[model samples]
Target: MTEQPSAAAHAKTQADFAANLASVRERIARAELEAGRTPGSVRLLPVTKTVPSDRLRLAIAAGVEWLGENKVQEALQKSEELADLPHLKYSVIGHLQTNKAKYVARFAHEFQALDNLRQAQALQRRLEAEERTLDVFVQVNTSGEESKFGLDPDDTVAFVKQLPAFDRLQVKGLMTLAIFSTDQIAVRRCFQKLSALRDSVREINPDIKELSMGMSGDFELAIAEGATVVRVGQGIFGARALPDSHYWPGFAH
Candidate 1:
């Protein structure tokens, strides 16, 4: 059998995790201030993709109220294990498969990356079947990168026009992934596009109120561009262990 960590080791791990949470919170506050927004205006969803449930609970105890997971199965398991933590809210912030809508509808409070109308329809069906309402955000391809999975900027208006048919789902705002590049201007441009898209969407439908952008790497620029929700993973929790070759859950490396 493998050696188990001692009580002292466990305590130290929790302490380190607490310290890291403090540092990340400070950075988030500073980013908000620089962007002319209050720190309370931003919601930090710590993506705990491949991390252990125990460590996730440690982060929660350290005052992490929002947690994000990519896969429905993994999140389901986490929720089962962390069921007693009432203060923490879980979110689905990845490319959601239509078939998996049932799982997300049951567990998540917010579904961040709803890309196409079909996915929205799927979620609507599931929510109706269960007699529930879901809060969802439209994913925008801000970078104009073909590899990303969101609606093209030109197509979003038409798509949003069709969303009212889904009675069980509510459109909260827009979410986007920036192009990974060293140039800050390029990153900022991606965020600006998302902001512009939000502006147009809100002009037509004032209920679309959020912009979920930024990750661990480009979150500062994203916040500067008015991101109300920022997903930070590796920066808060250290590097994650890679999953077996068969599946790669959506997360930053």
Candidate 2:
């Protein structure tokens, strides 16, 4: 097990994390205002993938209810470590393999990368056995990058239509990883593609309205493009040991 920080260090982490959390929320609120959207309209999902479980206690104390993780195993480990924290919810925002559906079904509150029929079926079966339901977002590769794991734009509508069959999976909406670039227009277009697809997606399934896009780097652009849920890790939790791209799997959001 990773050793806990000393008392002094722990206190510092708490104070620093609380401040960062507040700052990120303020940024989200500001972005909402600039976009002409109602304040608190967009939910800030604190991505907690590689963040230490100790620091997460501080985040929970600071009133963070939802924590997003990019890996099911990591989420499971932290969830086990912090099982005593009440009202703490976990969202698996990473690519979930079919074999790992059982773990996600066991505890995750949400799964944001449902892009395949097989994975959905596996999750549904496991969730049924667990007697639980999960909120899910379909991932779309709007950046058109070969490395990104999401439904192709042309195939997303049909894929979404197949989701209602899985009673345990509540299709929330669409999600995407816009290309990681300094080009503002390119990033915005990726978000736009997901937003536009949500319109057509909602036609078949009206519940599909939320869009999970953006990361620590370009969340402001994401908000302007109609992202309802933004996955921000480094922004609120501070930097990890690895590059941001390494943490994102292939999506690098």
- For each candidate, how many residue pairs have backbone atoms clashing (under 3 Å)? 0, 0
Task: Tell me the alpha-carbon RMSD of every candidate.
Answer: 6.6, 6.6
List candidate 1 stretches off by more than 4 Å. Answer: 1-12, 244-253
Specify the highest-lDDT model's number: 2
Model 2 lDDT, full chain set: 0.83
Question: What lDDT would candidate 1 get against the real structure?
Answer: 0.80
lDDT tens readout by residue for model 2, 67-181? 8988887788778888998688899988999999999999899999999999999999999999999999999999999998999999999998888799999998899999978
lDDT by residue (1-253, candidate 1, tens digit) is 1121111112226666777666667777888888789768988888877766777777777777878887777777778888898767788887888989998878788898888887988898889888889888999898888888899999998888888898888899999989988787898998999899899988778999899998877787888899998888766776566753423454334
